[model samples]
Target: MSDEQDIQARAARGWRLWLVFLLLVLIGLAISGKMLTLNMQEQAFLKRQGDARILRTAVIPAHRGVISDRNGQPLSVSAPVSTVWMNPQEFDLQNASIDRLASLLGSDRAALLSKVSRFRAKQFLYLKRQMTPAQAVQIEALDIPGVYVDREYKRFYPAAEVATHLVGFTNVDGKGQEGVELAFDDWLQGVPGKKLVMRDLLGRTVKHIRELEPMSQGQDLQLSIDLRLQYLAYRELKAAVQAHKADSAAMVVLDAHTGEVLAMVNQPSYNPNDRSNLGAGMESLRNRAVTDTFEPGSTMKPLTVAAALMSGKYQLDSVIDTSPGYIRVKGKTIRDHRNYGELDIGRIITKSSNVGVTKLALSMHEDAVRNTMQNVGLGQVPGTGFPGEQAGVLPYHAKNRLVERATMSYGYGLAVTPLQLAQAYIPFATGGLTRPVSLLKLERPEPATRVMPEAIANQVLRMMETVTQQGGTGRRAAIEGYQVAGKTGTAHKVGSSGYEDDKYVAVFAGVAPVENPEIIAVVMVDNPKGQEYYGGEVAAPVFSRVVGGALRMLNVAPDNWKPATQVVMQ
Candidate 1:
């Protein structure tokens, strides 16, 4: 009985063990099948999830375009720089690395701590921007966790304050802020590129995967300014402003034939590279030659005489009686510097007689006076495309009041920018052709529109030539070997309470080598302090020095050059 029970028990145990072994094999096969499915079908899904943590799309900075003068001199440029950034979420502010970073960046430790704490949840934050590459290397050497450096570009003005008003400046983000930089921002800006990259836990790029898009560099710009002339004009104008203690000053020089702005400068200019004082005010930032306007004063006498000549009512030899030295029109008395008695049209211009020009305006229709000025570009924008350029105030009173007409004849009751005045004089220089003013270099001279007859323009130019001779108001504007043709102007500034007797703007506009004219320039000194505020005394000298140097620099043969006297050796 015991043997049968033992055999039965052993059989049951053996069967149980065989069942356990089979169950184990089934479990192993199920596990192997699940592994195969995951390896084959879900591999891409897993890889993508893993890449989300370490793979990044990074920006590749693009280079900004260059701005150069007419002769290929660089006025503005872009230099490579680095921006120090950090992942605030991963940054350890409590670590000693923060102190080292603050020291290297020249940042306040408290501010750095406060900024990091404030933006602790942010994935990215800028620590410092526009650092030199050398400086960035020192920061990178620290190898602080979460800290990174990005390549970028910083705008640099090579001309500094010399051409700052014209060339302008860019912001920290490489956007244009003022001047030509703002006017042509779209043309000067570049497109940043992107690339796929793999990074480590420290957020440093380990390897580049592929370029998403190629970076497009900005296009270069060529301006019409001649750097040589610009330097000369700047020097002379700055000297005049200092000598006269003027509130401000501006000067513009143009290639008479091409209408290209050879030199344009203003006083109280600031360096674009140094922005410490950028927020001071707009006075230093303004391009006054194009933006500011003033009453043109006696400089308009030549144009009035030109208008009279255009009417065929007055010739160079035509006479006007200026006896008593002053005339009252509509109860407003217009007086000359003195009694020149009777003066011909040419002598009237040479003497800058207010009464003489007023008589011419009274005799003719007001439309004739207004139309001639309009044709010559007065009270117009000058079409330079410069930012904030003013069209100036050219009022045409339909009433045609005698006082208004008389004042307008002598450059009163009207306003003009220095640029407009300079462009207006271009007609006289180019034989009555008024070309569009250009700030950019042109492959060829632009087409011109005739504003006055050639004969009339030449005759007016000849009449103006007497202004720079001895006894003329602009005698100080005379050059040694050049026939200078110009007029002097001094006008009381109109204020809240009418014209201010103490405030005056002195201006001189002229052309050089009158026979075969090359360049035309305008100089304006506003609110000159102390005595000697006349345009002939303050502004005319600047015109002479700047234009004389420019004429010689261009190698233009002087029309008034006399042969040196030869002495025979005894």
Candidate 2:
């Protein structure tokens, strides 16, 4: 037990104590590091859950507007359809889910899978569209995950092709494609509603919330077309076209008082319910009444005669030397189908002589003839609401008088739509007052504008009546028991380069029941290829059929028994 031995033992004990303190410190550091790592992992896991889950935005499509006739008969309307939508991320592929969903939705699993795969990254996906209400109900009842039902609207034409030209149809996106639909698309399509919904990690819809104001539907429209008259017009036009074995035809019936289009039909029209049946051609969708322009031919004779008499330029009995069938003007030869020499004004109209009209045009200078034609509603665009309404092109009064005026008198150099001609004749039918035609259904007051004196218009009407009677050019248009006033047209069809010789557009325009005109119908036939290509042969019969059928439908009584006209002096 020496002092040195005691010091050695104490130092050894100090070394042991130092080692124990170091071990304790090392143990404490290990525990702190482990706790930090666990906290970091917990925070990361919560962050991941938040990122994976999201609130999806749901779209609510706007419903389209309705179109109805004056009597509230539905011309066009939208029906509720079910659309199946999917969030590809949510479609958990299960045997029962796939089978049940496919059977209910009438879709193949492969197609559904393909669509979902392509759209998975996208927030919204459409599975199927335009399903009927019953089908929609069946699909919604499936109640499968990721499968949801949305209400959509599909255009329905209850009248089918009856009002095809006026009502038109909408496109796949529910936007109007033509006719009134296209013209009023903005007003017909309203704002859509939108919603924000929260989803679970499995992509299940969990919460729905309103993120903005509620949406509204489009305003309904009322059209001016009378459904009954529309049916009659279509029926008659179809019958005439079928009987004639013609390519295409157009007809229009205007209310004599209001100028509202009571009926407008384009034959060989397509059914809006079946868009597949139609090709995207000018023929399929063209509104012929407003779009197609043709030489008015004999139908224009009344305009010239009326202008002649109205201007105090010529008397009804004034004789013009139209004998031997030709008038030489400015070097151009105006000839006719027959040699009508020394014809009076009445005989000139009755025979529809080209030479007679040329002389009449010459008698009244070029500017006078052009002005009269313009006053009759040619060379102007119809102010109807529909788009694509053509402003019929009238020939410019050429520096060459003979060629221009002669052609103008016979409707050779000018082009006009059937609708334009129909509107133009309104003044003659209603004592020389014209009103704008309407397509809207709401009641519009009949506003008449004085374009000519009532007396002159009456004289013109009487002349037109002669045109339809036994001796006139439009004799074929005479209704058996009715007093009809109309004119026939036989004009060459215009080609790309110029007027084609063989091609023709034949037309007839007139009013029925001479005592009191009720319906004004205009019929046009295109490219009738026959030996006799006159308007009397091609268009007069059509006018007779359409006018007759429409008159019967309107309950218009015939004026034959009443004997309104004078007997022939011969």
Query: Which candidate should be chosen as best, given TM-score against the real structure?
Result: 1
Error of 1 at 299 (Å): 1.1
**Local error of candidate 2 at residue 420 (angstroms):** 0.2
- Tens digits of per-residue lDDT, candidate 2, 145-228, equal 677776778899998887877788898678989898889888888788887777655444578866655667887888877888
True-structure lDDT of candidate 2: 0.79
Q: Local distance difference test, per candidate? A: 0.91, 0.79
Task: For candidate 1, write residues 1-570 as lDDT tens digits.
Answer: 699999999999999999999899899988888888878998898899999999999998988889999999999899999999998888887877777799888987898999999999888899899999999989888878899998999999888999999998999999999999999989989999999999887777899999999999999999999999999999899988898899999999999989999999999789888879867576799999999999999999888888899888877778999999999888888899999999999999899999999999888887878888999888888777789999998899664578888888889999999999999999999998999889999999998999999998998898889999988999999999999999999999989999998999999999988989999999999999968899999999999999999999999998998889999999
Instruction: Tell me the deviation in Å of residue 549 in model 2.
Output: 3.0
TM-scores of the candidates are 0.95, 0.84
Clashes of 1: 0
Question: Which residue pairs overlap in candidate 1's backbone?
Answer: none
